[model samples]
Target chain A: MSDTFLPVVAGHAEDGRVAPPSTPRNVPYQNGAPNPSAEALRAQFADAVQRVDVVWGETTVFVDRARVLEIVRWLHDDPTQQYDYLSDVTAVEYRDLDRPIEVVWHLRSLPHRRFLRLKTLLPKGQPLAVPSVWDVYKGADWLERECYDMFGIRFEGHPDLRRLLMWEQYKEGYPLRKDFPLRGRFSRSEQLRQILAQNPEAKYSMEELTVLEAFDELSLEQRNRLRSGEKVGE
Target chain B: MATTTRTIEVELSTTGLDAQGRPQRVPLATDEAGNLVPMTPAPALEPELEGEHMLINIGPQHPATHGVLRLVLELDGETVVRCVPHIGYLHCGFEKIGEYRQYNQIIPWTDREDYLNSPGNNVAFALGAERLFGIEITERCTVLRVIAMELSRLISHCVWLGTFCIDIGAFTPFLWIFQQRERVYTMLESWIGARLTTTLTRVGGMGADIPDGWTEDLANFIRTFPAVLDECNTMLTKNAIWVGRTVGLGAMSADEAINYGLSGPMLRASGVAYDVRKDFPYLDYETYDFDVPVGQTGDVYDRFLVRMEEMRQSIRILDQALKRLPDGPVNVDDHRVILPPKSKATSDMESMIHHFKQVMEGPRPPIGEAYVAVESPKGEKGYYMVSDGTSKPVRWRIRPPSFVNLSAIPKMVEGHLLSDVIAINASIDIVMGEIDR
Candidate 1:
């Protein structure tokens, strides 16, 4: 990551030549015009761009999971396609357990005024992992973590890929997965018992305790348990 | 422990009198001609202390946090060395619950997420669902939605300004702003019969049309609202204390702001003229004449200025919407999504069947997905929904602006004084309901 912060060049709206943008009218379903950049992406990374579908006036491009990082970096750095904004990072799990999970990234090219959806499928049998776009857009930090916490889709290159909305010691499995029950896996009384049984001292993570130089003062068994990766709730 | 000395430069008003009216020693010294000039003396040098830092935790429960947001900071004396924000205390899995509910049934859930911007959230979700169902709302419905959006923006920004003043030690503005907020709420109550948790919009239209004389009330608000805002501006915009506390704190450049996905007032304050209403232009916003306010040197001060200006701009849009609100049905004519009138449903066989089917199994969109974003008071709030040709959405994701904006708290709070952390966090305008959802 670069230490220096460089401002992105202003968008097309800054130029006086182009007409002011207006609301899109009568947008067709499934056959609307695809973003020009989608074609440009296919031409640039022929093998990586799997499929481009225009649904409800938005273009969604399916890409190979391995090259997602390279593609996102190029999109951010490329002058004509400066998708400097990362709108959202989320994963979708189909009810049919046999189908592959689709991890979605919503990227916007402010300069070009284009919205694009990038999806990569994680087959059921294989590990649910994909490259992180945190290197390209720093906004992906919490988003990717939330995706992992909810859907168990691991973002491979995320620096601190821990549970976001859930506590670090939470052992409820992925909440948004197809197999996860609506009220949760544990009974209400069990959930209350688990909550009450949690250790107050574990509120501060091991990393935070290290910052206080208090980690070395822990008991031998506690240190051994922490070293063995035993979480508080476990 | 070793004793350490840290010299801090504090900006004090040159009033020459303390709170008790006693003559106080000012930072400025009088020259021979009795002219007040800045004092120049040899600065005190401090000895380096041992490498010891203190950890401070502020709120998952503290009032100044605005909501249930916990920020754990590692401080070196008074300055923050590092900030690790812990959120999700308000998380109830809104998105997870959304997958189980039908499209219209999900409208009430939207209200609970961003409670402050409930009407705006309803409109945004309706727009996304309408797109998924390939339905265009009526003209009157469009104008009504615009009204709801601008009204919600007004109230949300009012709450923000009020709480922000309270956070920064100003008590008067909080009362003034909340008074203005109550007026908007009154109009909302008369229109939708609900105040905070207003499921104002249905998939193709509104839950109900505005009550009689509601436009006059709105017009009255639009006229009187700016005066209160101007009063607030007079109180704090140039106040030396407000400037001293907020100026140059938690600054972000335009490029950095965009990279961090900051939106709404947070992005506008960084000199980025990106407003979703202007750029994306849903709900016929393109036809409305309103300027997108941008700020220079994005800081807490700039965020304040941007939000204040945005409330004024919202009034402008509301004024236009009121004048151009066409006379037509608020709901669409499609029986698949909207039910026929109760009078007609009882008389006509087909209307009764349509009503029964709609009530039994909710209206389902085709197999597709749509992501609709709106210029919410907080920022670019988006609702992304995917339909699998079912009554309930396959996946519903809320692209929360505050969540992304709050993620950059570490960058903003680091190297600042511990007290300024509160000010910086307030400027982010985060709603934990939306962030943790």
Candidate 2:
């Protein structure tokens, strides 16, 4: 509706043909040419950008967690850079527990035909939180939620940032975290017990139940339980 | 009030014929203008109910949902006021699982996520792994991968077409198109030895090459598949029911589609013409000639048209790939990644040592990360692998396209009728395995 998406990007030949993009042959593990947007990003947000690394011909710019949202907004809104597409929002937790957790955002500039990776590292001692880019790209909604669900990272300012891959009532630790065991924290029998103990009527969230306006008609005990900010139905 | 005698002459032809195939000539009442009088004075209209919105839940397990995707709809009468989609029904934690498995060992898991496009997933993962390992695949392997990708795309789009038809109440096309899907599966079965979960690629090469005369079978399929597609195209492309159900429904502008990270047919249908193959080429897809069909309105019908044309273009690519497929080794000559031949390993001690090391410890990529995306039938399916100089990756991430595309459903379905939600959901072509993964 805002008319920001251009009809065509680079790589088009003058004869109305798409320029042939060949597969990279014998690409090195590191030190490939970085995306030009990385230079522009560093120039635009000098203090926010911590470092840039070109690995496997992909450019990764590590930015300060506090300024990630502002940098992303600039990347999306800036006409010359125009990284309008948010490909993925995921986090990487190294096997070494002492290493900081890295949150990665893969952004594609269709107008400029460039791909840039933005990362923000959260140290172990501090709370793992990053600003949400939902305002810039609505597609980041579920990606950020899944990141929160999997890695227990708080996406500040994401509306309805509940657990995505895991249910709201799931009690086990983040499944993708380094400390989480391969065979889950709870034993199989405990997992089964938890499943059976779940209230069927609690399938709909409290926000969803408000649509029916059936709160008043509920049992007094159930109403009181819901009023106490508990999510249980019985 | 019509106490006076009044006869209406209803046009018999307009009323349609009876069971006997003749026009029924029932007595009719006419006003002074010779117009047909109302039957029973037009039954009084039902009183409008206001101030109450109903809630409807469609499956975590409904047939129309295609898979385990649940949607909670708040409806103001039959019109949907809001739609809240709940996924994760089939979340098996493939990414978490990928962290434990070796790079080559993770191929089978990729097949299970997007089960319909398993081969394409295999090719994408292998490409990512190869990039991380800094290994260059063979010329023959490159063309073979192109064939596999296009064939996989064909199968996926065929399944989409069949299921989409069934979703919109057309039964014949589903059966017809599924017959074609089975043919492709049969071909894949011969090539990979498994039909559904074909772990068809390794780090540097394919699982196997085409058996003798297999290219002829592919050629035959490419030759005859279009006729079947043409038949199906005639059946559904301009059908009055299809046009009525799909046109102008769940439309997204190009700007919104790109901002939402849509790709493949979903993005192209919005008229952006941004295809991963054309824009970011892999597997030498640039060498093959094909057209990326684009649509104007980005509606359900445009998605349908884009997929149909994409299948035809895949045929063209397949035809070109078949001709250009060179004669050489399928796997790279690198012993670190590819294992030695069994005969050579049995005879030569050095070959045996190479095989033993590769099998025992697995191929380890350098401490780095690579994100490789392929234009899967659903969209841009990407595999982002991060290695800490280990055979197993530090983090393995799947950028599932349907997950992002389906994220926009709440925006697309809010203002439409409840029935159109099914049409719109089918248009998104989501595989819950991929979305929930």
Candidate 3:
């Protein structure tokens, strides 16, 4: 942060403080990065992450997938650089790349009034292996799973890596990816039927099967066996 | 090793083969006491157990859930061990659709995202798009925008308060508040063409000018709102049961609130005075006379109080906006931004051509990116627009308030009782459309 921007950033931090006396009513919009103090903070992140790149007008900091756990641990535990919260973790699918997908985590430090965007690109065809940030922020568990479910970018250390909004037996590829059809293959009722078919033996009687009546019924064991592609008997 | 092979005579029986050439049931192996037992399949090796807990699915359509927000909660009985919110059930892919639509055509999509505050949603998108076009809105347009936004804020809060009461098992307040909310919709309908999804405010101005005596009607509504708020405050704010259910429940420290990117009433309830309007004033908000209310304890009660107080402040702001109503052209004169009137378009050749161009291809924004944040009813509603010097925006992303505020749910309800989940959710005031969009 430069000298001029330091006071403005400091003013924002001070304003965030509980019951600050005489908060600055108006702060001029300082669009440029003018404070050297921010440089030191930026340097700390530059040393830790593998590479920081600005692509397509977005700032992204890349880190090794293997060292994600370490990076998040430091980000949350380090006192001066405490990013105690993981705001969002979303994945973007780039069809042009060899990996074709990247997971991005937006982290924030409330005390310092600072934020950082962390990115990790995984190679295609390789088993997804990124440590979970659930232990650090607690909020990342669901976000990471959502990202995993949407982009097929797995978080290796996630507690439960099941489909979130989509049903368990959904065969379609990740929806947020570029290739995924915006208008899905199935109709609304068909989608519901597919979801209901996942748990066939749950016993929805005729009266209960209002909208989802067309799908065939099977026992839970039978459904599970079929889903696993097992041959029942010769 | 040499094995002695014996030819055994066996009877081949095919009594119950299905049409698919598969047996319906196979003979089972016999266990000790002449009891037949089915052969057990081998279990897949499981991951190492970190800990054990119970799992519960809250909703795809459960009561107390604001919309179709489904939460997979790992619980230890009454206490929430962990929460996983599953969004996208209400996702219409608004951002993706916006890319294909014209600038004005996208306003209705904004209304559906944050349905409770349609006007605010409209203004946020309109302002961002207008800023990109470098269109200067006249004084009358700005004042009208402020009034509409503040009224929408009050309406939004009324919905929040009503639904929050319902979540807490108080049904009467919901009915009482909705009665008042109906009036707001009626008032808005008079100004705009539609009631719920108005799509009222255009990019550089409004779709239509305010009708006669609209200010008096708004003033009358504003005057009545305070009494209705008082009734709600008396009914819920001080009720012993209400206090017991909310006070100190799902509380978060100021640090945690900010770090989690929590904003709106949730952040303000945590004693942070970071209202985007007050911090980053826009649309003549700097001249508005109002107070930014903050709460002491960052709990459900504090959030409730903050929103209630905010409704009052919104009314105050609305009063000032109505008092300072200016007379001027509602839309900017720039033909590139706003379409000419129908009369002019039909009569004049130049107007016809300008209208034709604007309708066929949208206004081309400058080659740059800008983010504008507003203190929406829910929280900080920010619009990030990237234009490539084209008629259509390259990228349009909304930093939705409900989406960010919903991130604090698990942290807020971590160790709290399962019953309190509804209270915490109500405090967050999440709209699934906004969250999933």
lDDT per residue for candidate 2 within B1-437, as digits (tens), equals: 00112111223223334474333334446668887543344555856776588899999879989899999999998899999888888999899999999999999999999999999999999999999998989999999999999999999998899999999999998898899899989999999899999999999999999899899999999999998888887777655557667877898998999888888888888877778898888988777777777777788988998898889889999999999989999999999899888999999999999988888888888899999999999999899999999899999999999999999999899789999999999999999999998
TM-score order, best first, reads 1, 2, 3
- Which has the better TM-score: candidate 1, or candidate 3? 1
Top TM-score model: 1
The residue-by-residue lDDT of candidate 3 on A10-57, one tens digit each, is 123345332322212222222333222234435665655666543222
Clashing pairs in 3: A1-A35, A1-A36, A1-A37, A1-A38, A1-A39, A2-A34, A2-A35, A2-A36
What share of the reference contacts survives in each candidate? 0.51, 0.57, 0.08
Question: What is the interface RMSD, in angstroms, for predicted model 2?
Answer: 14.7
- Model 2 chain A: ten consecutive residues of lowest lDDT: A1-10
Per-residue lDDT tens digits of candidate 3, residues B1-437? 11112111112332333464333234456678876555565675766555556667678688788898876676665688777666667767676566556678888888999998899989988987776666668889989999889888978888898898988889998988899889989988888868899897888899888899988898898888788877876677646567667867888887777666677888877776667675556787767767666666588877887788788788888889988998989998889888777899989999999988888887887665445567889888877665667776644566777887886687788998888998999889888888777
What's the TM-score of every candidate structure?
Answer: 0.92, 0.90, 0.72
Candidates 2 and 3 compared: the better one by lDDT is 2
What are the lDDT scores of the predictions, listed in order?
0.86, 0.85, 0.69
By DockQ: ranked, best first: 2, 1, 3
TM-score of 1: 0.92
In candidate 2, what are the lDDT values of residues A63-173, reduced to their tens digit?
A: 999999999999999988888899999999999999999999999887677889999999999999999999999889999989988998988998877777777668897
Q: Model 3: runs farther than 4 Å from truth?
A: A1-163, A185-196, A200-234, B1-57, B72-84, B346-349
